[model samples]
Target: MDTDVISAAIDFGLQKLSFTEIKINQRKVVESFLAGKDVFFCSPTGSGKSLTFEIAPFVFKYLQKNDMCIVLVISPLTSLMRTQTQALNRKGIKAPNKSSLGDVKEGKIDIIFSSPESLIGHERKLLLDLAKKNFIKTVFVDEAHCIKKFGLPDKKKKKLAYRPCYGRLDEIRSLVGGHVPVVALTATATEETKAVIKKQLCMDNCSEIMVNPDKKNVTYWVHNLPSDDICTNFRWLVNLLRGYKQATSRMIIFFRQIKHMADVYEYLETSLKHDAYIDFKEGGPNDNRNRLFDMFHMKTDDDVKDFICTSYMNPNGNIRVVLCSTSFSMGLDVKGVDTVIHYGPANDVDDYVQESGRAGREPSQQCNAILLTYKRCLGSQNIFPSMKEYVKSKTCRRAFILNIFKTIVEHAHIPHFCCDICRLSCKCACSCEDECVCTNTCNQVLPKINTAIMSNEDNDDSDDNDDNDITELDDMFSSDSDSDVLESSTRKPQVIYSSDDEMF
Candidate 1:
């Protein structure tokens, strides 16, 4: 391991980049790349996963003074590719928008950004050639969970999107062989999903590092409505949003079906009179979708000038709400989303995690997540155990999500404003007509338990001079913290109520 390379990377990040923090996980990731090991990483959204891969190569190239080093990035969406390329260019790195086999052979570009399909179809031979000669240092797959959607397509015509190009990622691995390192990055994935990614990419003995998935600043709420009254549910959602303090804050309303989105969009336009935008497939081409996105972000009018000058004030009533389906879930990065409202229950917990995690990206801003659903639709949508479990569960909502991904942390460390259950708030108003007892205990205040708090020390790898070794990396992974582990006694302990209590 080269300490100089790591140090140089940190210098570049702090001196040149914006809002950059060289986390311990990032340092370990770069170290693994230097040692020639494959990596499988799972962290929460807005955790800066891109920087982990980018810093290592930048540092490596700077140390060797090799401007010819080529790093290939494979993404599922073109929007994501553009986002990364633009960011890299801001850091003074040469990432070409267009390049050919001759350009790659001559090392005309430091990084090449392409979608999975383009890499497999247009640059297949060139990429394999670079791998054969060990010219490519690392092959990165961002949003690696797309492997499940595209790797094995369903024969039934129910899914909205499909791509056979993702299946060919395995071919890239076979040609690259064991000498080259491959890194798979994603914000959310279960252990089973992780296994599929590792196997699909032919990653042998890959290292796994999972950052804490719990988002402490965002509060979760569930609104249970009558299964038969769809109109009433929309009205209820409209009232909720109308009551929020920041009327112009960015919001995404996710619908399970396209028809439901259309229905709600009509109501918001006619009744609430909000400049709401609708985003879904089969509606129009990408140009229209891009226009709608700009409107929602308040980037399309003369008021945009004042909005930017005043830090996004919205004097001209800009578009704030976007009604969308699952297509809006992945690959789109919108910052400071004040709230995320699910028009219905998600297909499963993983989907719920990924969708809801979109909010509270900026740690300083508080965000909320609301799930509106009916009990009857839970089984139809494969929401097993029940949507009632989520709305009525007596446990901390944060704890419930963390337990799903098998994360272990003391309850005392969880934030006080964790969720509706932790705070004992029943906004659902579920009546007993459906045998739901949640309404009965809505007003009861549960006792908070006092326990030892778990804390992780802040480890600053930028200041360290020691070469990053495997032994230090193992300690970081085993402790289950993104950075360093601090002493529990130094922090104040939190009091959280247990979920098993009958009145919780």
Candidate 2:
């Protein structure tokens, strides 16, 4: 392994790029790439999966100063492609947009970004020609699950979005030859989908790394929206947002269908608007129009980017709630989203993971991901089996989700900060080593559990004497505690409740 090269690559990522820390799996993926091994790795969305492959060719070029150490990246969405291209350029990598990909052949560019259709249709010969001479050092497949998503042909009427060329991705590998390494990365992939992705991408003997997809900082729950009382269900959200200071807190409401999204947006907009306490002179904040926005596939790429950048990234920007579809999910990383609401069940668990992963990108902030559903969506033919199970499960919500992905972490969060099921049933909410800090992010969607004082086995009030009275306990736990016994209790508790928990 090029140890120095690898170290340099990691440094470049942390210092030049926005990556925060080194993930063990990310390092291993980069090492495998440098060693000329095909790599297939899965980590949570916000974990910076792109850096694993990007660093390989980057370090390769840095080590030998070879402008021909080029990499070809096959991305799924055009929005994602544009986002990455700009990010790469920010770090001084010569990754040109699709319009300027012709420069790749002249060694002026270090990376080439293309969609499956464009790669196979337009740049097929250029890539193949580059591969013939071994100039293309590595091939990358971002959001590799798209091969199964847009590629597979259904027996029923094909949706216009279907593009079977995704299944033909192996042709690019076959033509490029096996001498060049291929790296495939995704935030969500099941065991079955894993086999499919490997076979489709010709990653028969690739080195694989799988990280647990659970995000501890983000809590999870499901809210049943009764069909009979639409206003009642919507009023709940309005009340929750009413308590939050929209400037610092953010929420994302996702929809399976655009029609329903519009309806929900209209209701939320009208409700969230500044209310006159008594038909006041004006209103509290009629600026409600600026408080919400909508994002969907219908919007242009620039519009989507603008929504994300200004609404979430820009502090002065006013958008605190977003009504959107799956279009806002994939590869769109937004930090500090305090809540995420799914208006209905997603088509599958993978889609759920991608869409909900958009929230809580900031490590310091806690997010609550709530899936709102009706009776029909629970058992719908289009819904994934595990997704349905998730809505109905009474056990640990995080445990159930981890089981779906076959991932295990040494420390599962205590019941209180875990999920609705665990919070309601967990006998050991205090088991987590870290002090649990209730961020107040999940009050409306999930129940809160206070495990500070253990309950008596006999359910007796005998142990609840004056010393241990609730009033005194509050003082002990309060910020200004000065008592010797309450010194440690003064600091706020911080049990994260937590893949793409940012990958879309």
Candidate 3:
């Protein structure tokens, strides 16, 4: 990194972005962008992925280049596009109105943040017009993994066909030019997914800068809930929250199903009675989801502690706690989160890596990631092989994730606050210390997987009246059926697959 670039980044972080210093990864990404290369950069959440793309306009401004030379960011969701728009506007940068196709063609906009759906539909003509004038210097695909899942529509599913823009991202290269730079940014991408992204995006000779996915500051663990009862799960969560209430206070609880989220919310809100600070959030069939989203991510001085929402709930505040779903994974940029608790094991280790990556984003703060799992969900879903191996293996958890990246690390390379296996082997620094070895006096504690039995309420056998008694939530899925809780085997598949591209 050049001294001028480094100094400029630091000044921008402190004065403009309100950060004390610029991150190394941020510097490298900016350098790459300045070099005019198409980049496939995989960095952990909160490591400044947004800044990598956002800084381009500022650099161009500094160079006294054509102000019309702008960056086009293609995000996966409307919520993310809105979030980016708000953040950039805060820095006094001009953000294109997402609804106005005319603003895209005007060439006065410094940057246009949009979704693939918007690009392929509303803004297609204007965006191509700008591309023809050589107005867009770079095109960024944020959360590029969605290009695989949401790209093509599964026409068999009517809802998915509504916005089949996800699969047509490769068409973005055509909208712009073949020679224009495309930067694909994602926090999590398996080796298989990477190959797919490269081919789909037409990045035959794209250079990649992948920082190690492991966050040494974040400690990982799996907690086996002894019972299948939702109440039992509730009790365990209360205890864990109470324990981490002090220094490592901020947290997010992730869920795999909407009904499970609703069920847990009922128990906590109705039974436990912590409704003010804690709330339930989910993507809706309408703007209701978006409204709850702004309340959480758009911080006001009045905001309080403990928001219980879906993974779609963005952590904007110095949120001490969150309860959400898989939608929370990828490209979330909140900092100083002390913990991330998954209500159950993720669908796969890749999902696990992305969700767990949210914690301990600030290098100065060591955070904890706890995965709570029940035996039944595992049996019903046939948990991913890596996830199954992750829970049962007597090896280093961090090393397991690293191996996913095809890197080999010996036991000797394990960090101080190592995983359960490393700690049990007496390889952790706290092994000899009666008090916890953590600088914060927190021990590498791995509670025995609970042996509690399922309550009758959680038992599978039930009368027909159970379906009639269910309450409707705001989401698209009907919670009354087991089809809602189980993985894809039982539910209506969200997207129909025409090729292997849709599988992941």
Candidate 4:
């Protein structure tokens, strides 16, 4: 199992920390990184995905017996880039910003951190110069999902004048120039997003490591609240705070809109008035755009932690809660987060999964995820209408969530390929005779399925409403009915052949 290699990697990382911390999953990722292969890691937030790449260079340096630049971690969020650079510094490793390429050329750093845009200018010249001197090796794209839209739309532009420059990623590739291996990392990437990364990075053959998206250690429960009062929600939050007061835990509460964030913050401040123990950091959506930039350029671990707890007090303590929107969900890793309370229903399953994934990162069995929802007019419709898919799916909760990606991978056969893992693992496969293991499992469980059907039928017949519902039930059971045929199929068939001339 390469336990010594794993231990050495841990020892290397632990030198920077005062406390003892060992992450097995992080070690596995390090092993993959050391093999000089491109990886697409699907670990949840707070599961130490960043540390996986951070510790890889150290291992590579020891084994390869050289001090060359083995990693170039490109992050979309400035905050994340800064956080990573600072973390490297804490470990006595110099990971400077790409903007300081001139300084780096004089042997001032071992790693380079920058945004996709920052690497395109004079920075590419410096990197190429260093490459001639044999100094660069591996490239890591932190939030690789953004590479999909590498040069599409300026964030400053509000109108629809967005034109995509497809060659932007290609330009970066030309700069790197095939000398160093590239590892792209992300917490949430659809199949389309991954294809964009592969194409942009110019990786001919890439290996993927998919960490199960389900955080089973975190128990999930939803609350149906009656009122839309921010103050009322504050009281409920206060109760949660009191419960976790003494426990060493962190929390992130998600809001749907900027105005909702402001409302919640104001209500908490006023209602919890002068609660010296409580601290909050306000991350307004507009400000978050720049905050990400600042985070990428940060120079220390303390700065990274500070940004995480920006809106909360005692960030390093056992309990800290940051009230944020969707911006906080992607590529942010923190440990011992006991709860992630969504103040409102998420817009889609993807958003919900990513947000809920923040809890129970350390493999504990007692973590909790509380979702608070209410009936509110999001425009003319419910903002969370799509949640019905999750609630109504006949498949297991985990299977249903994973199938969302499977559907995408199936539909988007770009670069002339489909998801092989989905085909092998999904329950939708036909039979074991077709070389499917899930099909065998399904067949073995068919008796239970039959029992369930009988039980449902018995219950339906025993119901008091059965007699009154009989006429409607008869209409439903009439398979030959025109209404039934129309409702069952939404598509009109087209005739593809004519046989009148052949008959003559």
Q: How many collisions per candidate?
A: 3, 17, 12, 17
For every candidate, C-alpha RMSD to the true structure in Å: 17.2, 14.4, 9.2, 17.6
User: For candidate 3, which ten residues in a row score worst on lDDT?
Assistant: 297-306
Q: Relative to the unseen true structure, what is the C-alpha lDDT of residue 142 in candidate 3, on a scale of 0 to 100?
A: 88
Residue 167's C-alpha lDDT in candidate 3?
64
| TM-score for candidate 2 | 0.76
Instruction: List ranges where model 2 is wrong by over 4 Å.
Output: 1-21, 155-161, 228-232, 239-245, 270-291, 314-317, 426-504
Highest TM-score: which candidate?
Answer: 2
Model 3 backbone overlap count? 12
Expressed as tens digits, the lDDT of each residue in 383-450 for candidate 4 is 33445455433434444566666632222211101111222233532455765545243222222212
lDDT of 3 at 164: 59
The true-versus-predicted C-alpha distance at residue 67 of model 3, in Å, is 0.9
Model 1 bad stretches (over 4 Å): 9-21, 98-105, 153-161, 227-231, 236-246, 272-318, 381-394, 409-416, 425-504
List lDDT for all candidates, in order: 0.58, 0.64, 0.59, 0.51
Tens-place lDDT per residue, model 3, 1-504, is 466864674465346455566677677666666666678989878777887677766665555446676888877544445555656777776786535446657777777877776677766787788888988888888888766544544444443432356667778889898777888898888888788788888888777888778777777776555555787677644454334432225566676655566566455444433322323334423222212211121111111211223222343432344555555554545555667777666767777788788778778786677777664554423246677677766678888888887755443534436665565555444444565545432344443222111221244433222223333322222111122442312223222111111111
**Model 2, 1-504: lDDT tens per residue?**
558866876676466455567778888887787788899888787888877666756666766667577888887656566666777888787788645656777767777777777767766788777887677888889888877776776556443325667889988988788788889888888897888899998887889998778888778876554442345546655555555434325677776655455566566667856531112236344332344444444332344445555456554456666766565676765666777888777777887887788876766667778887643544334556687777777787777877878877458676666776766654442343565554342333332111100110123323222122222111111110112222211223211101001112
Reference-based TM-score, model 3:
0.72
TM-score of each: 0.70, 0.76, 0.72, 0.62
Model 1: lDDT of residue 405:
79
